[model samples]
Target: MATVTESAPSQAGTEKYIPFETSVNYEKVAVGGAFENGRLESSWYKYASYLPHNVPGKQPPLEEFQHQDVGLRADPEKKALLNAPGAVFDEITPAIGTEVHNLQLSSLTSQQRDELALLAAERGVVVFKGQDFADIGKDRQREFGAHFGPLHVHQMGGQVKGYPELLPVYRDFTAGAVDNEIKNNVSSIKWHSDMSYEM
Candidate 1:
């Protein structure tokens, strides 16, 4: 269970406290609340909300999924990608969300991409500002995700016109068909793992 200390008053009135080392973003905690089993559980909704009850559809067999190679690495000479001076990160919280600045997602080399992944792993979620990923196109985006393993095609949501592997996350100005997805039980505001429904 979480180590709760003395209660304190905030806008939420007196609330239990946990160590910052074990805390997560307040927004997520506010939305999903948290459980204790030693540490605060702030990211459980990501996977738990995507179960068959939440998202309808049979997933592709595990055998069809691409497995991650334990020995993946970029070219040894590509050291510049590891320490690109153009990129900047501002942590939104001590536990989650880092806004990345000036890093060109399209221009990163394989080794650089590995470094980017490491940064994301270190900082829960990494946000890139003002990136024109549309111009970068579906193929490149798929290739970038493929660096880790096979890219997951979303079971729900809009895919690019020709790219089934690419999901369009940007809000288009036009109103399109509303997806019949489970929403009352699932929150877009909550944090979840990508395709957590899949094993």
Candidate 2:
């Protein structure tokens, strides 16, 4: 009689991400509904087109990802949360006592905002960089953050004029014409996780 062997079943919750040589994975990225066809068929093409020409030297043409069907699928609960309205918003409030710093907010879109809010809730304290606070203003920032819960005020001075919840993150400075003072210098910046020092 011939010997028979059976293949092991695929593991649950395994996700197949498109393999790329670069450190970043660019496959199966959940772009908006606009590009669901698995091709570069959206306004995003304009931004992607610049990468190759802008960088000097030979570059690879954009190719369809192989092994696209290899990953384990998302469970119903995970899919529901990802697609549900306000699910991401619900996550922001839970991050109150956690230590999170230096988040890249500009890279995230409206959809990602929901996911980020969820991350903030679970992780506690999310800091964002490259955010243009000019349009948001002090009041709006405070108000938006307050949706999660009551805002906490800083112990030392640095609160915004009307909104005490908005901290100014102050630094001591000295008057000197030749040397750069603390106010002018961006170096020696110590960014601690919010509320870590509070008693």
Best by TM-score: 1
In order, candidate lDDTs are: 0.53, 0.39
Instruction: Give all candidate RMSDs, comma-separated.
Output: 14.4, 22.0
Tell me the TM-score of each prediction against the true structure: 0.52, 0.32
Report the C-alpha lDDT of model 1 over 21-54, residue by residue, as the tens digit: 2223323533455645433343554433211222
Estimate, for each residue in 1-199, the C-alpha lDDT of model 2 and write its tens digit.
0113354565885533332232222233325424434433335432332121122243233333333111123231233334444322222222242222333333334344444455444455544434555345556566555544456665554455555556653221121222353447766343457645552
Using alpha carbons, what is the TM-score of model 2? 0.32
**Model 1 stretches with alpha carbons more than 4 Å out:** 1-60, 64-66, 69-82, 170-198
lDDT of 1: 0.53
Error of 1 at 119 (Å): 1.3
Q: How many angstroms is residue 157 displaced in model 1 relative to the true structure, after the best TM-score fit?
A: 3.5
